[model samples]
Target: MDSLSARSSPPPAATSPFSNPKPVELLKKVIFAWVQETGLPASICVRVHGKSFDLHRSPLISRSGYFKKALRASNAVELHQEFPGGPEAFEMAALFAYGSRLPLDPFNVAALRCAAELLEMTEDHGSGNLCEAADLYLNQVVLQSWDDTLIVLQTCHTLLPMAEELLIVSRCVESLAFMACMEILDPEQKRGRPVLPLRTFSDRPWDPEAVKELAGHDLWIKDLIALPFNFFARIIRSLRRQGMKEKYVSPVVVFYANKWVLSKKTHKFWEQEDGADHAANTNDKVSAILQAIVELLPIRSQDPDRNAEIVPVTFYFALLSMALSLNLSDGIRVNLQHCVACLLHLARVDDFLLPENRVLEDVSFSRELKTMEEIVTIRVAFKSAENAEVVAKLWDLYLCRVAGDPKLGTDRFMQLIHTVPVADRETHDHLYKAINAYLSAHPRLCNEDKARLCSSISCQKLSQEACIQAVLDELMPLRLIIQALFVQQLHTQRALKDCSESFRYMQCGVFSGSIPSSTCQLPKSQSPYDPEETTPVPLEDHLVQRSEHSEVEYESTRFRMQALEQELASLKHSLRRRNPFGQVSDCIGSLRWSSQRKYTNRMLKVFRRMSMLGKSKSKIKQRASASGSLACRSKSLNEMYDC
Candidate 1:
């Protein structure tokens, strides 16, 4: 009897090797043991995507409204509908129904939430159901943390209709938009800890500090790029609706495009693969995405103070290239072209050299050419000479690169060349180079075609080196070479005539004593007409002498004018003092004042002409120096021609 009592008397209060198990732990163990039991077959068979799961009906029906409703009809149940989160998520739900711990994290949280919703796990079914628990975890933890939110959002892609039906996608997108705006709009708000008194979305002035903060902390942008394009577009639209500045929003678009749309591997695959339904479907999806991105761009922002370029010119070119490849709508193409033309001055030469799409090679090239034409037309309409010149240089280099393509025809090439006005370019060196490239590439072209190509090149605008090169080029027609030589001779003659006139003016000035002899002296040995013997004067010396002489003359004339003014003032004072109410003094004072005004006006005109003449002489001197070099080069070319 004592031994029996010892075995049953709580073992003399001795501790077991393990501590006492908590109630929750014990419950988990019992539920897991029951689930693992093979002694009794599962009460229900749940089918998901051809896979079946044997689950007990008691725990499932108790915890899930969906299970309870389905199991009411029979003991054995077969699910014929699609399941959110797949079998793994369904298993997790089943384990939770059996009083097992449901592990909630960013990776599985989104799927579990959708699955719980589909299974109708809610407060009505149980006190703390999977749906409510998931909602708590997502709102309190996942959505609050930026990185976790991105992770969960990525998982939502697989659980579509239900995820959308449950507003998980919308919640994630709105959270992202809110956080992004908070980051850029009010940087003082710390991450993961949202504060109150949120800034309202109004038309506020540009904030440089916020932009700086955004530039420094762009990790959010990197996190967002991995999200599917649909979610990304929603976030961008949310940002826009929240009145986020374009400067803050555009970079996100660019980074996303760089990853998904502009990747060479992806673009090449899209271009090369054909005749497959999957490929066609993918093309359609990508086209829609691209169109959405284009529409989301801030190209239409009409804020007058928003002067900065929100979208880069290069990215616009990229979009245009993709648009051409996909054969997007005319409206989209036209809008893109307009944006590009408006910002054409900001484009680089490489921007125009779009990657060739071999599938639509001709169509793409022609469309690109049309874009160029549109840019030129818009720029020329503005009548901004500076922008015109920039466009001209860009087109010239672009033409040089494309001229080597064997398929580029003369008509198309000439059409591109004529897009820029002839007067826009100050020098045709780049144009000549482009034309030479074309001629070299198409060696079999007839003389008429060559002349037509060369006709756009103005001989007068060609630099000295370009002129020499043109004269020596064997591809050049005889008529062009002769025209080039004749133009050079005419330039030389004009320069010599100007120089002779300047010398004669200087000599006359010195003889008339208008200019000091020492400053205006000309060398007796130098004759401007004799080009062979004439030596070019250093421009710096002439400028220095002219400046010094002008200063001296101005100072002397100023001194005389000041003395005359003082004398006039004294005479007027004496006339007022000596002849009070005397009409004669008044008449004399008025006459003197009129004469002084006329004399000052005449002197001002004379000084203006002198300054003008000095400027003209300097310009003539520059022309003369340039013409001397051209004359030497021309002589060599002439001798070569004779040979």
Candidate 2:
């Protein structure tokens, strides 16, 4: 009865029966067979790299929009299409289009992805597009074993616009970036590790080849820079958005951002002479870069300290570096100044937290000094006397932080302090206190260090006092000396103003080279203190009025004129020597010119170089001393042997 019931159930649905066929499945099989050249006659001929491929037109048109459009516009039996990739890539795409099992491995996945994207194909079995399938395979399977990540990145970069259009490059970039920061697990660690290990920039995957390859692409990185501001911001922002476990997003962002900035700076386009067009273009680029940086800045204000630490130090520094390099307009510059200042502050904090990062040590120091120089320049340009106090505070903060580093010692701290020009009393006092506080905090600082630092303070005080006193002393002495000299000159002028015509004529005749004789007739003045002064009469009246004593009077008047002239010359010389205020003002003007921000920065750089040279010399001297000691020991041993 059971057998009868089973037989009555439509013969168990006739498993694997061919009577009612699946036409679509059968068609796929026929297409795969056609690709292998084992089924229906090929209707369309496709040539890739001079190799003719026999393929079906219906399947190619159905699977690939690129092919559909190409064949629709052509009437030829054979179609010629260009594929930039290898022949193997096209072969994989052709087989993939026919519903054949596409063999995806590390060796061919990237190439297949490129080809699939180029051909605009979709998978036969899955709902996913072929480009997406290749992307998944490349990232999940192939990238794990693939060693040449840079080469793959280069390939993707070459086809950036197309790859981006296909929505496949993102995964490729993410995978590569993940690998760049992936921690290398030990054998034991690997055994207990999760399926996907998490990492950050702290893991520090240092691959020299990767760095070299990235540097090689620096010239072509303009593709990244040319991306619209939103796209560029999205690229950086998305790195951190991937999951909480991934802290490495910032490192790769910084690395690429730095490269992008450097590339744009050195690009041939910006090297052109500035004009209306160039300025407009430059402004556009500056705007784009500024917007991108603003987007990358930390948004959280809950914890100020952690906010900066959230992003790697290099990211902030890269932004700051780019900011300094850009020719931002005054309006933009003013708005972004705070942003730059915050970055510099954050960078210093990072350096403090991670002092062992020798890679960033010199860069941090150079950047810090450059930032100070820029701030000072801007302040000076504004010429706001009130800002001087702010500038002094800033310098104090910088100096305190620098002195806090045990390696720098008190000497370098004092050296930096000496570079500051004389400031107002209040500013100087604040700076002094800041320095003292910094020194007091140093547990290892010795008495000699304290004494030396104290000496720097005392020297500053004494120098400032001396400058003030010099200005005051010169001013007072100059005024007094000029007043005394003017009084003596006033008496002489009164005597001259009171002289009558005959006396003046006798004096003039003797002084004038045209006169043959020194003697002449003269008349005495009524009073030396006369309120009204009169000009001398002509020589005839004088000659006739006092002929008897004319010779004596002429000699006396001539002597008086000579004495007055001598006194007048002395007065002029004295006045010049006594005008100390003018001299001091000129000196102050010269000092301002000499102590400009640019000059001060140059001097600081020169001082740094000299300090480096001095250290090198000291090292050489120590080496020499050690070698001498060894030589002396050898000599003693030889002497002992001889004895």
Candidate 3:
């Protein structure tokens, strides 16, 4: 045979070129000279993805089984179908077939491998084929290095089923998983120890020590962010199988989702800028990414042993927001919603204020409200009082924010308020403020709606200051003001009734001779009620001083009760005569309830102190006067009641 025919002939099966390397430089020079000669033109044409290559059929058929079979029927072949790595990869294969060295690196190795497989360039056709050469380089060089494995795995995204069938993706994932698990389990690895030589395709030099020092335990996590979601999930599963803890795995998952999924430009509910088909396509892609991320997330384990570190509540909210914006599967949406609801107490008011793209104006708050309802129900079921209060307060603040939107209707506003159970709120201060905010914003709301909105607020739960403000509020409905007034009256009446009973009990204790008379004479300057009197009194004189103080408080309470009766009577008459729609500030301005409240509080304090002072002596003459004082106070209370 001629030198060309001998060089191009397939070597014997036992003597592969990979085992005993051949010097092909002279043959390459001869082939180049032959190709340049004008008298000897190329014999065949190969077309791929609109690009054409004219070449001699001898070298192509000898190197590639696919070409050897195709050229049997004709001299020209048209590859109109999609190629594995596009035209660039096929160019490399063609160059390799021509006895030229192929440039193999982590970035292009996976694609070249798939392209070689597509061309059926196996050892059956030649001594050492492109497919075998690519596989050897990938296993020995690419998978052995930390950074190269990631680069090759990323390249595998463009080479789908071919790369998958060649097990290139699985090999890269296994390598990454093993490295990550080692970094987590081995303390030496955690301290920035380089496991393999740091070599990468990029021009930028990486200092493993610096990265380990800066990223600490999360160095592997930071490196894995460039991987596509499908391969990323595979790596995560492999890591889990290797007994890697979820605490280390969760942050990277969250980071990946944030980088790829949440950062995408989502279609707004009201936007039709993109055509329906384009929007639908984008939605489907985003939905797939989101679902994959949710699946890779660690299931919130109830078992303490299995429980790992939790992903941030903010990320869950963000995921849920994105999920809602797209037309996602119900299962994925529900999973995200449940995750958010579980950690709802850790959420902030701004978390619920989802972006405009996610929130439909027609159902502005329905999704959030539904999540809150779940939280409320869970908290109530578990009897988690502290968390219940937290959720309640959070909802109240959120309500205050949304209440100002004139678009928020009464039913929705009321739904938000009532979503939290009545028992969860320790005080109605927040609820009352939220209601006031809603009423102020929607001034055109009819009286019945206003009344219904305010009805959720319990007058009994209002602080004394809030009650006073509510009474003076002109926007308050007439019935609510009356209820506030009635609550105030009940408080005052209870205080007076207790004061009168204490005085009568003490007078009885004295008249029944339960104490000695000698201890009843207290000096006038050392009364316990005097704030400035620091001098200590003997136990008996303290008792007599308490008796005197109680008698004085009884007289004061009796007079206050009479004043309250007159004011209440006046308020009732005013309500009956005045227009029901009139402002309450006009009627409440004349009442001195602020001062009356102060005095009533002071009298109650005196009564409480007198009770703790112990039953003791008063002289018979003083006791008779005390009895007369009690009788006169009791008579005044009865007369006021009758009036």
Alpha carbon lDDT of each predicted model: 0.64, 0.44, 0.63
Write the residue-wise lDDT of candidate 3 on 117-171 in tens digits.
8788889878788999999998888777676777777777777888889999989
lDDT for 196 in candidate 3 is: 23
The TM-score of candidate 1 is 0.63
lDDT of 3: 0.63
Give lDDT for model 1: 0.64
The number of the candidate with the highest TM-score is 3
> In model 1, which runs have C-alpha deviations exceeding 4 angstroms?
1-62, 98-101, 184-217, 265-288, 301-311, 326-332, 354-386, 404-410, 441-451, 474-479, 497-501, 516-643
**What would the per-residue lDDT of candidate 1 be over residues 1-643, giving only the tens digit for each residue?**
1111112211211111112234235444655588577455466777876777666778888988887888878766555466666666766777788887766677777778888887888999999889889988988897886666766777778778778888888888998888777766554543332111112111232222232334323556756766778889999899989887666677677656665665655545665664456566656867887788888776655631241244456667777787887889988887877777777776777677344664556522666766767766766786766567888888888878777766778998898788788888878989999999988888777777887898898887887668667755667664555456555545544554565455445545644656565754446553223446467655345544554555454344334334533443443344344343454422221335554345334333433332343344444442222234334543554453331
Error of 1 at 620 (Å): 9.9
- Model 3 stretches with alpha carbons more than 4 Å out: 1-30, 33-63, 71-81, 86-103, 126-128, 186-219, 264-284, 299-309, 327-329, 354-386, 405-416, 442-451, 486-539, 542-550, 578-643
Query: Which TM-score value belongs to model 3?
Result: 0.68
